[model samples]
Target chain A: MANLSALMLARDLKLLLEERSKAVAYTSSQTHSSLAKGLGILGFHPSQIRKVTCDDSMRIGTALLRSAIEQDKALGKTPFLIVGKAGTTNTSTVDLFIELAAIAREQNLWLHADGAYGASALLCQSRRAILCGIELCDCLSWDAHKWLFQTYGCGMVLVRHRQFLTESFGTTAEYTQDAAETGESLPNFWSYGPELTRPARAMKLWFSFQLLGLNTIDIAINRGFELAETAQSSLEGLKDWEILSPAQMGIILFPFHPHVPAANLDEVNMRISQSAIENNLAATLTTRVRGVLVLRIYSIHPNLSDDEMLAIINGLDQLAHLYLSRASKDDII
Target chain B: MANLSALMLARDLKLLLEERSKAVAYTSSQTHSSLAKGLGILGFHPSQIRKVTCDDSMRIGTALLRSAIEQDKALGKTPFLIVGKAGTTNTSTVDLFIELAAIAREQNLWLHADGAYGASALLCQSRRAILCGIELCDCLSWDAHKWLFQTYGCGMVLVRHRQFLTESFGTTAEYTQDAAETGESLPNFWSYGPELTRPARAMKLWFSFQLLGLNTIDIAINRGFELAETAQSSLEGLKDWEILSPAQMGIILFPFHPHVPAANLDEVNMRISQSAIENNLAATLTTRVRGVLVLRIYSIHPNLSDDEMLAIINGLDQLAHLYLSRASKDDII
Candidate 1:
């Protein structure tokens, strides 16, 4: 559904520009590939997609974006859509939405926030501030299946103006004409997205919200943030462990390196991840941070206790030690 | 899933044309709007989409398609993809796939069969012939949810070459490196479509097939065809009723006209549809045949008894009589 949202916004933006051949879209290189996939689906060529470099926190660089925008304009290219990553997939890093929104306003570009995994954070008072200026976005895509703990098929797209969606996808056939004009009392959802025969995606979100109030959902999200902090503090205490990205919004990116050099650091971290999977220890995976491979954890489960966090650390430490010991033993042989 | 399949194919075809600015796609005007929607999502302009006129049977006219292709080429547009409707939404009209395949082959264009509703008929030996030359198509999109008695979220896409899907959507991020190279033994589905985190849509189909067996599923589909035949025969016998399109592949289109002029026929059909919804009756719908309004019944449910089909006819006939009487009474007053 997040993809649907991006595609919808991109299509409207293109239509709004009247199919400018040189029209381009902008997003952080670290933002989820779904946005790029959606843009590609919406007929934007790979060359037309400008992936602006991100900062150390994996946030889009405002200066770099402005420079790229200016460069594109000088080259007779139209930059119309700018995406802000509210919560990146790699480390749950929230981009500087306020800064991005300001740039978008200055350039008259459509601002979209890909809050697929992080928009639920808005329900939590402590974490909501991370997504400052989110409301200023022209559109936002969020997934209830991700952080809200609902099953799949519950992603949502929010357009500042609802009519934009209807205008984008409101074409109806003879069979669908009645439903389309059923008035505001009956919303023909097919007019809002691509799929015509869609499953009731809103029901799951509605049921969850009804059964567990917003307060309860917020508490669950807050627990994830607490657990990430714990994981970060625990990693810092380890002698061989180095924090690549501090835990924020329920994710941490760290690498384990003892005597391993920078060249072999990626190899060791990869081996540890493989060992974790091989031993069925945990779901710890590896991602690159600033071109360096590192272990990444998504501490999003509300029920994950401190004991589980400790166990995860212990498991990683033991695996790393085993991998190093094995390497040393191979060398001796 | 059907949308993803079409978009993937459309994107690859455009890329194959080396991002030709004048690339165009062809489909019957009677084809599902999803095809056009997918093409639009893939960046094709409304002008690039050539909606070829359909024949009386509502199938795509091949002569018109060939002429359109020539016209587009003459206009410096490269026609890349041509979509054939296996079972159109309105009349269950199966396009002349054999003729379409010949045209696609002669022109070297990618042929995609939008069989979302009718492809399941392939499981029944007696009904498979309706989709003759289906094997010649480059790609096909089918929905298991529609006729296979599976729940929603069960749509399948078949490509002539396995590598095409991977070639279209096989990019990997650092975080996805481990899963991307899981070897030939394990298929990474994310590399085959736009979605990364998709629900296990195949499980429902798998369980249905395992529990009910292919033979039973085939029988269910055949039952729908039988009921459609029964509906066609029944509708033909009714006085003042005209059969717009004969029952084929579990769909029948007809209109009841009792002293009603051609001008208000559309209104009458629409009113019947609205009344069906308001009265909480069967899910009856209306469609257009050669710009004429008609009521369409999809006899897709396997357990739709002969009695039920008769009851639907009776209800529609009674409603038509009531509408005509009310009109005459208003004229007299």
Candidate 2:
């Protein structure tokens, strides 16, 4: 919902400035899929989203993004927005926001950061450097439900300029005139978003902050990084597990290859994931990293102990061996 | 939010059918302002909305709507959706939905009914006739927070064909592939709407219905009509007051104009409303009925007694007399 609002604001800004409805936005293939879906909902064609290639580290390829913008402009498409990821969903890779911010400034585009999964890292001073350039974004969307220890349905969108929200979503009606702003005070919140009668979503976050001091909150966030690193180190000790993406922002990906063909590796990893769930070991899942299907572990629970993480890894290794033996027997048959 | 989703579905349906981005929608001037705001958020220009004038009773003018559609079509605009009000906010006037449904069928347009305030009346067999043609709507947005005795932030949008929702909002990502449907059962709810992670909003409504059976719920809704009629009867006995809109669907509108000029009528009624709030008499507000600023009463509380309703009306009468005398004294000076 936060990303949807940001794209709406960007689209409205382009309409206001260039009076162009055929506007295009730039985001890497590594960015969250919700951004493309939001653009489609906002009346932009699928072709309007330029999925620029990503680097080997899974970060957005900055050169490809620049060239895509230039090409779109040459083709008479208005380039209006650049979406950068503070921490992507799949591999938790942070995009090159500094370079993207420079391009946004040069091209007069809105820079929006999808910080839903990783913005909570900003609470921990030591881990904040990875998202250094996030401050330069025109807007940032953060989800408290992800890493902020909140229940579901809590997300926030922060814009550099407050007026853009009112410009994009301000509403008035005869029944609501009594509650209208008098110009001496802030406008009613209905003007700032799509909802006219929404719950006080910030109250939960406020209560959480008041209950848990910043020091404790920062430690909780830092624990996520510690857990991810523990999972990476434990996986490195395994025989045939190849780390597809190293632990970053509480997410790590790996697959057990064991000199198997590429086609069999996906099947093997998938069966291992299914076995773990079936055996009630861990509720793990598989995701495609680069072109290979890999087991992805998102270990962000502050209460998750290091021993529990190691047990889950070892259990998955055993399941992989069991599944590989079955596959070999089938091949022999 | 429900209306916003309906407009998005309508927009996407238009895109699928005609491949036209310049689609126009029809709604009455008395329709909720949120419709226009939602269209703006969906990238439709303000001019794309044709606010057809309303009749004297505040119902949508059907002839004018037909002419407007014809005019837009002549100008090469794609008319794709028509919004009809089940019960307007100010006067609680329902539009000619039968006429609207017929027109939509003939024009091949999507018909949406804004039943946020009045859909709950469907529980009462006595009041259900007012919303007779609501079932013919391609989609209907109903808010349980109003008229249904639920707390705020409970709304539901029902589409005639469930497939339209999936076509408009179905989304998939690598991280969510494991949860994808295998085509033999129902799809995950994320495919049906913008939210991927939403609270179970239906639980509250379900609980209410379970606790208070349909018969009790029906009586509670019937009390809304009884309370409005009580207020209307009390206002009719008082001097210097005229009913702008009669009691209908739990709403009534009137102005306290005791031979006052048209210019002072708005000022006098507004002051009366303000005094009602200041004196803690009632939280009454004013709305324009046929361009006349009038006191609008939305009385749907089942527990409110007829005596209490009479007392509030008498209290507003006293405040209006006090404000009018003071204004006359100032005029003499």
Candidate 3:
């Protein structure tokens, strides 16, 4: 929802200044799919979104993004926005934000960061450097529910300049004039977002922060990094397991590719994931990286101990061997 | 939020079938401002919405709406939707939904009913007739928080055909495939609305219904009507008061216009409303009816006794007399 609000502001600003109805937005192919869905909601055609290819590390290819913008301009399409990822959902890869900011500045594009899960790393002193250039974004969407330990429905969108938000979402009606700001105080908060009668979503976050001071909260965030690192180190010790993406932002991806036919890797890994859940072990899931399916582990729970992480990884290795043997038996039959 | 979702579905359906990029929608001028705001967020220009004027009783002007649709059609614009009000916010007037449905049928436009407050009337067997033809709406947005006594953020949008909603909001991503349904039962709910990671909003409503049961809920809804009626009758017995709108759907509009100068009516009434708040009498507010500012009362509390309603009205009368006499004394000074 924060991404939606940022795109709304970007759309309104582009229309106001450029007056071009056929505006295009650029984002890395590894970025969350919500960006395209939001742009679709904002009435942009599917073709209006340019999913620029990412490099081998799943970081956005800055050169490709520049070329895409140039190509759009040549095609008479107005390139208005570049959505950078602080931490992408699939691989937890942080985009090259410094380069992205540079391109946005050169192309005169609105820079929005989808920092839903990754922005929470800003709480940790050591991990904060990974999101260094995020401050250069014109807008950033952070979900407190993801890494801040809040429940669902508590996400926030922030803009560099408050005027753009009001310009994009300001509302007036005959029935609500009494509640309008009197100019001596803060503006009516309704102008900041789409909702009019919104719940006090910030209250929960305030309570959490007050109860857990910055020091404890920072430690909890760093624990997420520690958990992911533990999973990566444990998986590196297991034979026939290849790390597809290293642990980053509490997420790691790998596939158990035994010395079997390469074509059977995806199915064998998928069964291992299913076996983990069936045996009541870990709730591991799979996601595509580059084009191959790999098991993805989200180890953000602060309560997950290092021993538990090691057991889950070893259990997955056992499941992979069992599944491979079963496949070989079926071939013999 | 419900209205926004309805408008999104309508926009997508229009784009899919008519393929008219330049589409217009019609709504009564008395409709909630959220309609225009939602349309704006959907990338519709302000001029694309035709706010057809309302009649003296505050119902939609059906003839004017038909003429407006005709004019837009004549200008090569596609008339894609008609938004009717089940209960308008200002005067609590319900629009002519049957006529609107007919016009929508003839014009091949989608009919959406904004029933944020009034749709709850459907629960009362006696009051349900007032919302006749609401069932004919292709889409209806009902807020349980408003009239159903749930807390805020509990609004539901209903569509006659569910496929339209899925087609409008369906999503596919590599990361969420495991959670996708196998088509053996209900579809993944994420496809039905804008939210992906939503709170269980329906749980509260279900608990309310389970504890209170339907009979108690019907009486509570009926009590809202009784409170409004009591306010209206109490105001009628007093002198120098005019009813701009009768009690309907738990709302009444009136102004304490003493034999003072007509030019001072708005100011005097506004002051009377302010004095009500200052004296801790009531929380009466002001709204415009036919360009005249009048005190508006929303008496939806089921616990408000008839005597309390009468006392509140009498207090407003006393405040009005006090303010008017003070104004006369100031003139003498």
TM-score of chain A of each: 0.95, 0.96, 0.96
Tens-digit lDDT string for candidate 2 (A120-181): 99999889999989999999999998999887778889998779898888888888888888
* Predicted candidate 3 versus true structure: per-residue lDDT over B1-333, tens digit per residue: 899899999898866532435689999889887898888887788888888998877788999999999998898888999999999999888998999999999998999999999999999988999999998999999999999998888989999887887887888889997897678386777788887788888899999999999999999999999899999998889999998899998999998878877888888988888889989999899888778999999988999999999999999988888877888998921
**lDDT of candidate 2 vs native?**
0.87
- State the lDDT of candidate 1 residue by residue for B70-185, as single tens digits: 99989877888888888988888888889988998888888888899899999998788998888788889999889988777788898877778877776578778777666777
Candidate 1: which docking quality band? medium
Shift in Å, residue B128, candidate 2: 0.5
Candidate 1 — which residues are off by over 4 angstroms? A14-19, B1-4, B14-19, B271-281, B330-333
Runs in model 3 deviating more than 4 A are A16-20, B16-21
lDDT of 3 by residue, A1-333 (tens): 789999999888866633445688989898787888788777787888888998988888999999989998898889999999989999888888899999989888999999999999999998999998999999999999999999999989989888898888888887886777778366787788888777888899999999999888899999999998999999888899998889998999998878888787788878888999999989899988767889999888888889999999988888888878888989921
RMSD of 1: 2.3
lDDT of each: 0.81, 0.87, 0.87
DockQ of each: 0.55, 0.66, 0.66
Which of the two candidates, 1 or 3, achieves a greater lDDT against the reference? 3
Q: Pick the candidate with the highest DockQ.
A: 3
Question: How do the residues B215-255 of candidate 2 rate in per-residue lDDT, one tens digit apiece?
Answer: 99999999999998999999999999998889998899988
Residue pairs clashing in model 2 are none
